[model samples]
Target: MIAFDAFRDGETARRLAAAIAAEAQPGRSYAFMEFCGGHTHAICRYAIAEMLPANLRMVHGPGCPVCVLPVGRVDAAIAIAERTGVTLCSFGDVLRIPGSHRRSLLSAKAAGADVRVVYSPLDALALAQALPDRQVVFFAVGFETTTPPTAAVLARARHLGIGNFSVFCNHVLTPPAIAAVLGEAADRPVLDGILGPAHVAAVTGADAFAGFARDARMPVVIAGFEPLDLLQAILMLVRQANSGAARVEIQFSRGVTAAGNRAAQALTAEVFEPRAHFAWRGLGQLAESGLRPRPGFAAWNAETRFEIGDPPPEPRTACRCAEILRGLAQPADCPLFGSACTPESPHGACMVSSEGACAAEWSYGRGRRRIWKELR
Candidate 1:
């Protein structure tokens, strides 16, 4: 097994910090978007920004799948569960996210809905096999990194002739979301570079970002979810920006490659296809951004099997989750963040998700807001 202690070593982090400060130009600012919730959490938990040069900034992106999952989808899952002899299963985080009128799966369960939390899609399939009577729907959600496993479980369920297992596929494409974010940069402050997600790059490969980097004229560095990895990637971004290099680079070479796992990609393609349009919480409807069970797998599709309700009414809360996901605002920027949107009482999807930027900052870097104010 690979030793991970080196990646978390404090001395190495300080050395990397020194290198970043030395190389980052003092005359101009370098603002790069880290397009992964894991990286955002790492940055906050380690106080990486406090150790970096004053000229550098790490903008959070909508990388948390749970946070990006639109409220309507959660409403659909609740609707499915409320049906007689039907059970809805999802990852723990997805269950906590409030749907229409802030009604969560946990609340639905308390109100006699058969909504359960499963660690993996396979567990949902197993539950269906064991029950044999109740219809089981796995509310699938996440980026490319998670799609493959869901696909594998579906394939297994099909092979075993399990009739009760189905899935409500909410798997989204990262490239489209990334494109949407970059497109928004025209109106907002232009980002100098992009720190691509490690797990996403592992599935899509570093080459997946090559075209975007060349066309968008921004350096994209695939970073590992470690403070040292982010620090080193930040240094790489600084150098590329200084040299005027717009290209894709991989900082997490151990797990990621120019061409990622071919078997996983093939399996995923076999099980699912793209939806013409999918609504993201903050990003609105993105074309070909969401995934659905393929026609061949319609027998195991919950959306096709059940009658979902109308889309949830437009959220009208004090929450600024949309702004936070769009990189236009931070957690502390919202009035409800600490006062009303704590983890125990999440007023928004961002606070409900463990991978959300708002949750990361609230848990690890709330003091940064004060520091930022003092600096300003």
Candidate 2:
């Protein structure tokens, strides 16, 4: 393992910022999208974007799994929870995602559904074992980083012959969505580079992005959560762009490896198989963008066990979340930004998710700055 202190010094941050500022061209502007919710949280929490030169802009991508889950999927999960003798378990963030008729999993819980928030899949499994008579469904969502833990839970369920436990697998892939974003540049705005996900890279390896970089001719840096690490990754991308080099570089070397965690990868492969296509809230449908439990474990698959249909009626037309998630528009660009959609009562997925760009800007008090404040 690499030493953590190498990244903690403020001097490292200054050097990285200087390198980025020096390499940034005066007339040219670089738009690099960081494609992970955790990265979004790190950037806003540490105010990493403020450290970069004026020309280099960080565009938030559809990284948050909870945010990207379309309203219909959440409705399906909630419907399963509301069924008699069924218990729904999910992360706290997902519980609040609005469904049809403004009914969320949390709302279902309030209405007497057995909805429980769990930190890990194992916790849901333990609950299943404890209550053998009830059908326990774990609302599994995330990318590669959280897939192995779900796989581990599935393996335990099978080993223990736990028939009551099932999983609503909403796990998505990263590379295909990156490809979709690059393809969108033909009609929409073009992205110069990508600040790839650190947590996902730790599971799938930096090598996962090699194909995306080679095919799109876009430089991608697998970066960490720290402010210094993000700055250094930006500098590294600037250098690569200046030198006309398109490759995958791991700036967060302390946590990431070229090969990544082999054990976690193997476990994921063993339990899950890629779906032909899955719907994202903003990015729409992409081939092989999601995962389903393998046929051997179909008994524990909630989609099959619960018999959920395609999806119910979508949310109203007033929400501009689809555009906001694609990097084509901003939250302020939406008609209902602060007027109709505040943190207290969100109208769109962007405001509902904490790591969402609009939510982060609003909660951290960054977006609505007065001209006098800027002058000061």
Candidate 3:
């Protein structure tokens, strides 16, 4: 096992940063997008972007699950919460994300909807068991890392014959989102390499990024959240760019492997299947990128149990969250980032979650002067 403290050592981070700055070409730009919100948080929190060489740019991807979830989905969850005698449980991050007309589940709760913040699906399950008369719905939203646990809860609920408990599944896949970014980069900035999602890689494995590497010809490094890990991953990407080599490498081997956790994969497969198309806040619709309960677990599906109806017209254009999610714009570029949309009163989803790029920048990156300018 890799020493956790070793990844946090200042000297190690300095060494990696020096190596990166030394290897980075003079005029040639190296743009790498870290495709995980946790990594984004770490980079901003530690000022990793400021430490990087000018040639290497760190662009945030739509890795924040709450940030990427379209307003329509949030509206659907709100609809469930608004139902009489029904309880809606969601992760705290989703509570503040605004839906159509700037409504949120938490706001719905304030207006008399029964919404509760939960740490896990198990908590929702316990709520379900405790209040058998109430219809309990768990608003499950995340990448693969959190899907397995949601699956476990669904399986347990089914096994225990808990009729009132169901999940409003919004689980998304990572690789497909990466593909969506690369495949639709005609009008957007082309990425040189990717620092892949570390936690998602734990469940999906290193090889899961092979297809992206092969197709996009970009190096993918599954990196840990530590400052050292981010620095090392950037160094690795810079080296690959310098050498014109593209492949998927696992820098967070302490948590991820080539094959990943087999049992978790099996459990996920048994419980969930991909949706034909799913609406992402920024990317719009992408094929086979979302998950839903399998036929056997249909009884535990909230979408089928309740007709939440179609989402209202897309959220207003004042929020530039869609552009931020697609890497076309930075958080600072957003007009409402600090003025109209502080974390206390978020104008968009990106400010609602700490993992969101806008939130990370506001929390840690605001005071720092702009160190590197993108040459493109």
Q: How well does candidate 3 match the true structure in TM-score terms?
A: 0.95
lDDT of each: 0.87, 0.85, 0.88
- lDDT, candidate 2, equals 0.85
Model 3 agreement with the true structure over 1-376: per-residue lDDT tens digits: 6577887888878778888999999979989999899988999999899888887899999999999998899989998999988999989989999888889998999999999999989999999999999999999999999999999999999999999999999999988888888875667767899999888888888899999788878988889899888898898888888889899988887889999989999999999999998888888888999999999998899998995544544655777888888788998787776778888899899999999998898888452233122322
Clashing residue pairs in candidate 1 are none
* Per-model TM against the reference: 0.96, 0.94, 0.95
Of models 2 and 3, which has the larger lDDT?
3
Better by TM-score, candidate 3 or 2? 3
Q: What is the C-alpha RMSD of each candidate to the true structure, in Å?
A: 2.2, 2.4, 2.8
Displacement of the residue 333 alpha carbon in candidate 2, Å: 1.9
